[model samples]
Target: MLGELWGTGNLFRLALPDTFLGYFLLLIDIIFLAAILLHFSRKTSFNSIFEKWQWVLGLSLAGFITSQLLPIPLPFTNQSLTPFSVFPLLLAASFLNPLAVLIVGAATGLGQSLGQTNQLFDVFHFAFTGLLAALLLQQPFIGRLYHFLRHPIVSGSISMILPAFLLGLSTLVISEAGFSLAALDQSLYTSNNALLLFLFEGFINGVLVLIILKWLPNLRPRQTLIPSPTQRSLRRQLIGNFLAFSIFITIVVMAVVFNLSISVSRRLVLNQMAHNAAIASSELPDFQSELERLVDAFDNTTLFTSSNPVEAEVSLEQIYNSSLLYNQLIVVNKELTISAQYAPGEPEKLQLSEEEKLALNAVFTTNDRKIVTKNSSSVEGLSFIVPVMDDGETVVAVIGRVTQLSINNLIVGIQGVTTDGVGFIVNEEGQVIAHPDPTMLNAYWQDEENGRSLSIETNGIKNGAYQFYESKSNTRQLVYYLQEDHDHKWTVVVSTPYAVVLDLSLDIGRPLLIILLVVVIASFIQLTYQSQGITEPITEMVTASKTMAAGGNWTPSIHAQRDDEIGQLSQAFSQMQRSMKKRLNDLSLLLNVSSDVSTNIDL
Candidate 1:
């Protein structure tokens, strides 16, 4: 929305209205896809995009790599691939490189802005966030962040707030000073109204990147997978106390939530795909009518309708136009006379070899209607057909060929597959069309249940349901099914894991999981520090007690600052010291009493 406001007379066409938005967005999407494809191609051909310290770059590289190898082709072009921008920065911080972390953040924000829009501030919004992340990684005062994630303000209000304000300031100031398009920074700040929101989201993003960074090291084939778990000589035990029950309950609760999420995601995918399939299927009749109309026009203009050789060949040449999307649309008779409505880029000479001529003539004579596909080195199209016939039942001339739909759309719609999870598509053949797990499409994917394919009409179960099926890989697949008919019949299956389906209600699990992890780490650290505080006081008290018992004059010293359990120890130490002094005096008195008594009693 902000882009449109700034894009008024903008060069990148960013600020387009809805009517023209799709076109502009499409152009942007294509450019984005192209940039990704180029990136992927360069990485696959050259070397690993991974860097040891540059974790974000490695991940962006990995995401790009995965996208490159994803086998999900584009809608119009078969030669292209998609790159998801989320991974690289995730890799950057996760693996411990502050610089890469920043770079990844910048790249993702920049990529998002570029692909989805032409807005300048949008690019910098991402860039600014990334830059600050790098700065924060080294900031000396940001320790309390490592403490707990429940609140964002504790880790220095300035550290948390100032960066965001500056990011907005930079965008507005820079745009006003240099680019005309950058002045649109209002949306960025306004959306994240609170400083807490900014820091919480930003820091969480940073930590998320860190966690992903943790996993990437293991994923990297070149790097050693085993973590040399820091000799953290600490064997942790979940203590059997009040806390134990809470921990168990948390696990069970999470398990239930996970199961629920999977179920919901499955239902949503099925419902969506089924709706799309119904619409596509319904539109087929209209599409067919349009094709028929075009075919009728081509037939009347060409002389092949009369079976005249010379007239049909020469006259049809005049019937061709430059506006058509095809190079040629031809009507041929049994006599080999071709009346063709060729398009603008067509060669001047409309010549055909005997077999080529006969093949065309035979299609008119025999099949009544035949569809042939030929992608010449110069031109691209499929030979789509609806034969034009005469009243005598004998095929006189042919019309209706050459379609507008692209090959990539054909492959995806015709052969595309979705599974029981998000963004997954499965084809009629039960092959993985699109899935979150890359290996689900590949034969080697883990979880044997995932790789298995369930035939649609199985065990007398018809189509359309949230149902369970099995695959060749012995994986059980939960899928919502739909059939898509574009140029041909194809299955449009929407599926996610039953777990993912259920997870819709619990999308917060991501942040929660992060919070839980941070809590566990913080708890461990707190336990360590608390134990240290206790150890010194306890040790001093023990020493003082032992020294007094052995007849040594030991001064009492138990260091405890607070009036808690340790303070009680300090008070006890003082009492013990006084008691030791009194005991010494009593011993001396007893010696005198014994000496006097011994002399007197003997007389």
Candidate 2:
């Protein structure tokens, strides 16, 4: 989402650029805009240009304001429904020419990008949708067809559907969800709520346009007409509207609840990981204390400053035999030369390598305990170096414990790391000193050859979480790491596969889905029962009217029993039928009386 600006050494360095490609692309965009202007300038007349520009700029500003400040957040997804923002561009396409439409679209896109910090590609999405709308509404054949269907609602709704589809498709293409059905399905399952949001926005925008046109009749396009409602069955209309609104509400509610459940579950998992990291970090001081205690035992002995190598070796062997913590123990004199050494298998004295001697010299110079990994010699593992002093002033020798496996055991024994998770320790140099996988021991943590390259600051960060791709498992992992700033200066990292988080979310979502299903079923049944009450009386009236139209005697049988609107209608129908029958009988009687008088006159 970060926008790259072009910097120095570029042909057109507009700002402090992050990359040459971004600015070069900007230059190309400028050129393209100039070309579009040139093409439109000749075809578009300057007459009423100020009036047209007013509409373009005004609508663009409205669109920007609505997009930034008035977006309606949708439930169940991270997307906000911004149908109001699309209204202005759509209005432009309806009233103004294509040139104005394009300009307004571009300006609105720019403003939205500035407000939201969206990627540059999103601007194209807005512009393209606008152009599609313009073409649909302005092209001769389509425009005629649209006008032929004079109903404003139909025209507005149909105009929006294609543009909405284009916008959704563009969104999918620009994102990780390429041009694939499976990817789109996965995106809908995950976080891309926009796919449904766009389509919903289209229908909502259509209704919005209808309302606007009704309020401002002058804004309605020429040759377009709003027709009166047809005399359809009111019962059917009532039931249909009720069902539609109920279904819409049900979907929105379900989506919101499901997404909230997933979000809560994910947060719980993150919290658990953090708690585990804290617990693991709390145990580190104990490991450090154990190392300090081992060194303290040597400090209290005369083996460090003893001149006889045989005596020093005997003492070192005894200590090593008593404690299985270390594989090798050695004493180094002031010259950084090994004075005594002990290993379980090696009976003779072993000469120290130059690298080992330098390491010991560092410990002697610093006069402090240091933890290091020694891979330069056969006694490779984590080493603990302790400095020895004569009378607390002059340095005599240094004692070292090599191949201490206690730290490894401590890491492997840490609780709460799930079966699909791993916990390990890495030193300040980003070397994995202790890991469950022995092959990864002493391997550079950032080396791709070890499976994948990790770019985390293991030493600098105190505690944090990272999501990274683990090539070994070929899956994404969420890693929580804690750094302990002791003599060892090591980082403890615990990682669990991201799939586990999704699985947890699914476990939480299942119950929410069941609840939604039950609610929807209950609502449907209730609505069906309520609707029959309204429809049944209307159906009886419709049947009576049909009988009267066919010249049969018909009466409102239930008019006297009820006082609601249906009863009133039936009462009016019954009175009109009686009056007509009385008028017909009187006229027939008058005609017979006239006929008898004419017969008497003739006699």
Candidate 3:
């Protein structure tokens, strides 16, 4: 309490270096005030201003002593507790007028300053805590607090929590700011422990204040002239508190619901996008099977066995014309030279390039198919080569075809539908194989670009979704991807601008907003009904009362129809007005009788 700060681990300590001097000064102040209080003990007038000062001073002194002697340790902190010393000062402020509160604050601040290193300015910071509490007590909202405290259900719990929160809030702000200004090395507490400690302290002190208020009714703050304790309405207090709490809860619920809606929307969109991408990728043809069919056809043909080149060329042309696998077909001899060829507006016979010859040799020796890619300025094509056996083991000829491959063919169904959305595919070689924009085909991208990239491997693409900023488009996009299952050679990706996903969230939000609007309208209508009920009759009664007081022959128009407090008040007012009128009439009659008697005596 008095000797320790809140935090631990090199961060918590009393600010004053000279602990002995600080405690000594604090003790001397307490002793001095105590001595003065004892010396002045006499049969003084109970309600005198002098007596009030003595009480305030005595309370401050007791607070200082309490802070030193009965410090309660907080649960989570080491030697950290609020010096309930400050609580007595709060008690003084609560039970006294502004001038008395100010005096008590000064005395309390002086006593607290002794324990602080910044003796000169710490007094003001300590004084501010009481000052702020005093100000809050004077506010109209506090009238509701008083009524709320009177209720048993909340009295035990809220009375402690509310004051704890307020006092802790002020204490934290002042302590931190003061320490910062003094350039002291200290921490308030570990994380939120300080708040917890303050809360505990407030709970204890709140119980103390309640006890005092229950037993010592005379110590309560004197009521002010405007809307004082006598004028405070229980209904108004309850309604006001309900309105404030309801609004707070509504705002919190709205925020929670909004976040949950957006989260659900985002999750649904991602799942749908990924599903669509998987379907698109599944539609891709099995290139390996297509190549195998072409190989089987050439192996069964008798054209390759013909000795005449003319016959072989004619037969190859017919085969190529009928086939769906290739755009061009070439028959290579054992020497890896093209003996026969079939193509559109091209050479009938062509020489194999060094890479093609190696592929041809590989096909012949292994008796297996070989695939090679042709990349040129004109077109991108794939060639498949298979050994053509004459009978059992003789590799008489090799059949090869160059098929033009289009990346756009991979994603054909959906295009140009979404302005800010695109679907594309990446091959194992880290190249964009299939894209909405044909120009991106065969273009290689770095592993990481603009904060996103495809998962690439040597054999094929490893599918996964990712996000990135498209610099040219200047937008953030949500991406979903899936790799083709047949060969795992290409990954299909669907990307849409992030705003599109947010728009999906708005779809759900619009209805909620409308519902909130409807609720607000309903609340407004109810508030109007309730407010009118309170204000109208009060206004009429006030007018009638003023008229009667001014000697006007105004009859009370306020009806006591409802079986409620206001109705009862109206009936009471009417009864009182009638009584006043009857008394006035009786006094007038007596005055008339006296004047007549006096006249008769004079005659």
Candidate 4:
């Protein structure tokens, strides 16, 4: 079966699974397994049924068949809860040597490969797990300890769960899946469910093995008497418990402090962004109102009444050159033709597209001031349109001003935004009108490449803070936005990288961490010094007891100087040792007298 599975080409699929790293890892696993097989073959003898080729092959086949055929789907995950197919391999660990266990493991992997492809790491993971179980069971002390406990649950859990857990952990470390508290949490509780599934399978397999051992006692491995546990000194127990408690408390306190600091820092950053956003929102309308006033003033000029393009052009030029805010100033007559236009430095004829002409005509017909924002490949800016009227009744022409740099300057000049942060204006349609980067101008704010939408729902909210991942920089950003009601509704946004907040939190935590380190070190030193006062007398008593047991003098040389329990105990121990020596001396004298009396009687 193993040869057939291997011949199916599934086992060799791992040789090149998408990357050179996969190939390298496959080679390493193969070499390590081969080395284990070679080393164990020399050291292990095939004297047991578990080591027989027939039993190993049969168990391997069973494991593969059960795993492939029977799998129960786990709730809320793609993972399947399967029968513990590796039960036989774990059972074999108890009775056979590591070599036999590894053989079965490899055969099982071969069979699994026929059914599942690209599980090269899994094959070695199972093999190493079995090897570990076998090595552990083969130890005399551990085997005897398991026998002494005699509880199938305890025995099964130890032999099966421990090795499986260790092997799974090693696999995690070696695989692309990282080994950290965060990674483990994500794997167990989030999308990656491998770790939890592995442990669940191990536990089920352990129980199954325990049941089989009970049903077939003859198949169980022989065990010896478990040695008694050595007693620990009072001083050792007290010191160990004290240190463990201290460390545990320290960890708990540090975790609390760290979490609190992070929470507070994040809140402060959010609040700051919100405040800055509000200020920008207020400033936006004020700037827009000023532009509207300027356009209105330009509309009341006499340049629109004149038909001569040169005089109108000269007047527009003076107005355009007066302020850096206007990119271009134009005058359109009732026919929607650009009569005159002026731009900085070089004068060019203004050509209006049909769409732009219709938009300007609408303002002329309405005879009202209107704000029109343009966002396109060739042009990107806002156009403020105010109608020029004849004798305060009929609309004659429209005077308009196009400005891009003014709004960009307004957003860039907003105070309280950090140098690394960004401030931008998004129109009602979610299109960015002004930004620090010219390339980003006119881009959709919600576009994935620009800035993906926030994960949280912001419905019915006018102003608030939120967070979203910025794909451009691959960093999370803390964003605060406020909707401004001006000539056109606009959303002013201020954002900074979330890492800055984390750095601030870290700055806050640094002192706490240093204090924790110092406290731990001081506690350790103090405990060592204080424990010596209690442990030294007990250590001497233990040594004296050992000497007395070996037929040497038992008196302990301990100075009972301190007025404490340990000192009193030391004094008591010394008195007891002296009494024991005197009794021994009396016994020796009595024996000498008896020997002399017997000699005299014989004479």
Model 3 alpha-carbon miss at residue 400, Å = 7.9
lDDT by residue (1-603, candidate 1, tens digit) is 223321112233334223333344446544754564465466343233343435445555553233223222233211222223333433343333443444455455444444433444344344334434334433333234433321222222223354346444433343322322213323232223334444554454445455554665464223222322221212222222224554765677666655565455545545555555454444444444444554555455335565465665464455344223233556655665555445446556454433244446666657544434333333333444445556544454444334334322323332233433343333344544333343444222122232334333333322454433232311223454554444433344444443333345456455665676577667766766765676667667767778777867666565567788778878777776778777867988998999889989997
Model 1 stretches with alpha carbons more than 4 Å out? 1-285, 294-305, 310-327, 333-368, 388-399, 403-525, 559-584, 599-603
TM-score of predicted structure 2: 0.54
- Residues 255-356, candidate 3: write the lDDT tens digits: 776678767765676666766766666665554456566666764546775667677778777667666667767778777766677777775355565556
For every candidate in turn, the CA RMSD to the true structure comes to 19.1, 12.0, 17.7, 8.9
- C-alpha displacement of 470 in model 2, angstroms? 9.6
Candidate order by decreasing TM-score: 4, 2, 3, 1
Residue 339, candidate 4: how far off, in angstroms? Answer: 4.6
**Over 4 Å off in model 2, which ranges?**
1-236, 259-285, 300-302, 305-309, 332-340, 345-362, 373-381, 391-405, 413-415, 424-502, 529-533, 539-579, 586-603
The Cα local distance difference test for each model comes to 0.44, 0.61, 0.57, 0.63
TM-score of 4: 0.61
Q: Estimate, for each residue in 1-603, the C-alpha lDDT of model 2 and write its tens digit.
A: 122221111132112223444445445556766776677678876564566777777987776655444555544443455656567766666667666777677765654555543545335446655666665555443234446543434444555454345444434444342434333433333334455555565557656766776888787456433321221556565666667677888778777876787567556766777667666667777666656655666655466676787887787777776666677787777776677787777787766655456667776777766666555535555677777766664355444554545755667544355676788777677888676665666676642222233333344546666665544443456676677664346677777766666667667777877877787778777877866776777777677778878988645443545688766776777887777678877998999999999999999
Model 3: how far residue 585 lies from native, Å: 4.6
Residue 382 in model 1: lDDT: 41
Cα deviation at 243, candidate 4, in Å, is 5.7
Candidate with top lDDT is 4
Residue 499 error, candidate 3, Å: 3.8
Better by TM-score, candidate 4 or 2: 4
lDDT for model 1 comes to 0.44
